[model samples]
Structure formats: structure tokens, C-alpha cells
Target: MSTTTIDRYRFETGIYRPPSEGGSASLLLRYTRNCPWNHCTFCSMYKTEKFQLRPVADIKSDIDAMAAVVDDLKAISMDIGQNGTITRDAAVSLIGKVPALNYHEGFAMLFHWLLSGARNAFLQDANSLIMKTGDLVDALHYLRSTFPSINRVTTYARSRTLVQKSPEELTAIRKAGLDRLHLGLETGDNELLKKIKKGVTAKGHIKGGKKAMVAGFQVSEYWMPGLGGREMTGVHAAHTARVLNEINPDYIRSRPFRTIPGTPLHAQVNRGEVQMLRPHEQLLELKNMIGALDVTSRVCFDHAMNNWRHPRSGLLFTHDYEGYKFPEEKQKVLELIEAGLNAGNPVSGAG
Candidate 1:
């Protein structure tokens, strides 16, 4: 299946999202076409596409199309409930001949959104907030007005763009209805930040993150455990914890490094310029970071990539890793990491 540009909608969408959004019933609304700063060495999602902001008119039209689809689906449900079964022919007749509207990935997403109660939404593709503040506010307002049931709306944001935004601008955005901002703060170490081409310094991360929080938006800061490799692991963990302490974001999510093919980081690994940490080492690094954290933010090891092996059975990470509230469960999280370390598992390098 094509990863970008579903046909049912009048607009285009690029494939990318935070891991926390997975398995949620949120609708994926395409506000921007691709990553504005598609230069991060670890990301491969938007490398093939040029960044473009969808015109506000075009975005509104897409919102209208989505609303139409929802209305049609509701009508179909009433018909199906009364008739007992929905025939393919009947569905086509009711929903029209649009392939995406009737029988494609767009329809599948629409079905899931409806089934999931349409309480949340995620803006696409990479950083939606990079658009002009007035335009973004207008688009967000349109989105909420169109879907009154949506309780939360989220988007990825770059620290560079966000730091450039004034507190007033961020407040305007928050009042416009965006509830959450997910930042890929790969590491707080300046050297590691430069190595990863994250385009923001440690100060920039803290400033932008604090601005978002002050604007009343729940912020999720992403930390990569092994991004610094073996050489800078100590500083990576310590400085990341320090920054998180300063920002005190709503969520601290762990995205343990996984080298993907066709990225600069992968090239670095191949050339022996960087060495990935073994699973055990990564867990120990996480333990150290957790131990250093002094914030009220919730720490999450929920991503599949962060779950390492125990050498005995199942994952070293527990099921409650998603919302391991900090300070309260810090010791428990440390113990879990220690358990993984003591599991006698052979060191395995991540891809």
C-alpha cells in the first residue's frame, strides 16, 4: 500500500506519527505535507517529499469531506442496523463510487475513527505547527468546530520553530484548541544534538518545551536512550534528565535508538564512526536517566522499540511502562531496568 497520499481525502497525507498515537482512534488530519526540517539524521519518513503547507481553504474542504464521510457512515449504520446486514452493493450505492470512501484505506481509517468514538485527532505529516500562527489557529478552529466530539488534538513540533514562536503566539495556538505537542528531543547533550542534526541546542529544547507547557498544552518530550552510542552515554542520560527536569513536561517518552537503513545515522554506524549500545547497556542508560530525573512528568517506555529481552521469558519492560509516573514509580522503573540487566541476556545490538 502507498504510504503517502490516500485518495479518499481531497488533500495529501504523509506517513509519520509519534508511537504514543498508535492504537488510538484519533483521526489523522493532514495540515502540512511533510517535515519542514527533514534533516534529522535518524528520520527517514519525509526524506522523499518537499515540505508544503496546505492552503487553509484546502484544509477546510478536507474537513468538510471528512464530516460528509462521518454523516454517511452514520446513516449507513442506521440502515444496516434496521436491515441486519450490509451488502457490498448496498454500501457502494449509499456511499457513492469514490473508492476511498467505500473500500480503501481511507474508508478503513474512517471506520476506525468512528468505532473509536472520534475523541482524539493527530495532525500530519511531520510538524503541523510550523505553519503561520494565524493560519494554524484558523485551521485548528475549523477542525474543532467540524468535529465537536474531538477532545484532544496533537501534532509534532520542532524545537527550532517552537522557540521562534513567542509565548503569546503559543497561547493563541493553545486557545485555538491544540491540546498536545510532541517534541523529538533525541538527546539533551549538545554534542549529541549536533551529531543527530536535531537543529536545536539543549537551551532551545528547554525553552520551547517550557513555552508549550506554559501555554497550557500537554507536552511530550522524546528521549533516545542510545543515540549517543557508547562514547557519550553518560552525558546523554544526565543532560537529558536535567533538561527534562527544567521543562517538567507532561510526558517523558523513551524512544530507544534503532538504526534504520538509508539514514545518516545508519551510515555513521556502517563507517564505524558510531557504535550502538547493546540491549543491556541501553537499559542501564535508561536506568541512570530515570534515576536522575527530578520532575513530576510521567515516564513512558511504551514503544515496542524500547522493550528489551529478559533472557528468561517475555519482555524486560513491563506492561505498565506506558504511564510509569515519575517520582512515585521511579524506584519501580529503576528496578525493572535492573531486572533486565540481571536477566543474563546476551548483549544484542539494535538495528
Candidate 2:
């Protein structure tokens, strides 16, 4: 039992909210705190405390409270041009009807309506996947039935949980309308896996990812560049490629490593126990990863967290490694970083 409470949440802009969902427009609901499994060495997102599941009733009340203020919300949003050409009267009219709806059911409904047709939702805390499947299924169904317009419901899941769920269990949840899962498959090298306390092995990742794909869900495996640093860059790229080949997931997402102030990696950095990769070294690591890739998955470096040369370019496994030379892409990214260094950009030495 843990006693920690957060009463308000705001949507973060410019972060990947999963496209199968409506991307960034969905409200990022924080139903828990930190992460249940927070041992990943490169992660600094949730360093505050051990994870604890929020009380369902408490979450419901927050929704109810927010719902009560829907009218004020619309007015403020509209006044600030947030609703995009929405008139004050229109915002008020919508607010007047908000009371007619149940808060829990309408949390997502109001979000979609407020966004003017954008449809997706993200459950927060680092690992909403830690919630009981039954609870999640009911919550997701309530949102779906109440709104009818929500086509995508997404959450973050650790690889360990994915492996633990049986095929039938995953299928049941998928059928219940959980469409996408964003996995933090930071590295696929077993040695690096142990080094980072990633909580699951390379084999576990491969199995879990394949299970998600087998269950007919859109799966995105997030890979972290420069995670192995200068020491294990070669093995990291090669083994990560091996795992991806085995899983053949729908999307291979790139998240370049950034050590924040309070994470375990920061301590390692200070102790000289871990070395951060140079920008060009990271680019080569990315190239080796692409070259060793055997699956035809679409890769994305779309997050602002990365310094990809063509951030939107997709690694088609065929054209990306063959028709186009990855070394050239690497060079372009390195050159861009050098220019930024000359200009004194804050993330100058990063890629």
C-alpha cells in the first residue's frame, strides 16, 4: 500500500502519443505514479518513487471534477483560440450538456469533442499496463461505448508484462478494443539488457513482441540509440537487429539516449562506469542496426528526442539499407550536429 496522490493532468505537446490513436490531441491521464519496473538504466522519466496504482474511485472523482468544469474549460480554451474558431456561445452550449453525461464515461468524450474530432486517449503513469487486465478492459470499454468515436486506445507496457500474458489473454484484451502498445525495448543485446536492468532478456522481448503482433495489435518497439555507449556499440546494434528480425514488429521507434539529472545513468556518468557515445558513433550504431535489420518493418525517428537527419524517413528494411546508403544518412546527421556545435546549440553533441 502506498499513499501518493496527483489531482491534475495536462496534455504534453510534441510527444509521440501513438498514431493509431489520435496522436497528441488525446489527454494524457495520469492514473499511477512512476513505474512499477523502473530499473531501466537510461530512463529518467519517473525517478520520484516506487510505482503505485491509483484508486479507481479517486480517478473517477478526478474525472467528475474535471467534467464539472468543462464549461469553464471550453470558454478558456476558446478565448485563447484553443478550440480553433470556436465561438463563446458554442463552447457554453457544449458545456451545458456536459452535466447530462457520466464523468468516467465522458472524460474521453469531452476530450474528443473539445479537440473537435480528434480521437485517441493515453493512460499515464509510466506503466498503465500494470493495471489489472479486467479493470483496463472495463475502463476501455466504458470509454468506447460512451464515446463511440474513439478508434484508438493506447498505453505503455513493459516487455516483461507482454511476455507473461498468454496468447488468449492478449487476444481478449485486443478484442476488447486495446489497439496499440508502446514497448520500451531499449536494447536487444542481452549483456546490455543486464547492464541496464531492463527487467527482461532479449529472448523475452522477441517473444513478447511477437505475441502482440500475433494477437493482431499494432506494436511499436522503442529502441534507444547510444544506449550501449562507446564500449558495446557493435554488439548492441547487431543483437538488437537480431531481435527485431525475430519479432518483425509493425514499427521500430528510435529514442536517442538522454541522461537527465537524477537517473541511475547520471550516477554512472559521474563514476565513469558508463561512457556516452559520440554523435557520429551513435550514427554508425544506427547504421549498423539498419544494415543488420532483416525484417520489413517501418522505422521512425519521429520523436523530438532524436537528432535524425531526415527525422521522418522510414527504414523500409529494403530501400533504407539497399537503395539508399545508411552511411550517407549517418554523415548527414553528423554534419548537422557539427553545424549545430558551431552555432552553439544546446544539444550540439547529440544525435
Collision count for each candidate, in order: 1, 0
- Model 1 over residues 1-351: C-alpha lDDT tens digits? 232333434444446777666554578888989888888899888798899988999889888878766665556656666352333444554445454444344555655676677898899988888999999999999999999999999999988888999999999999999999999998999999988888899999999998889889999999988888899989999999999999999999888788999999999999999888888788888888999999998888677676677667677665453577878988887877777888867344453
Q: How does each model score on TM-score?
A: 0.91, 0.73
What candidate 2 gets wrong by more than 4 Å, as runs, is 1-24, 59-113, 308-351
Candidate no. 1 TM-score: 0.91
Candidate lDDT scores, in order, read 0.81, 0.65
lDDT of 2 at 166: 80
Model 2 error, position 341 (Å): 16
Off by over 4 Å in 1: 1-11, 80-105, 311-313, 319-322, 346-351
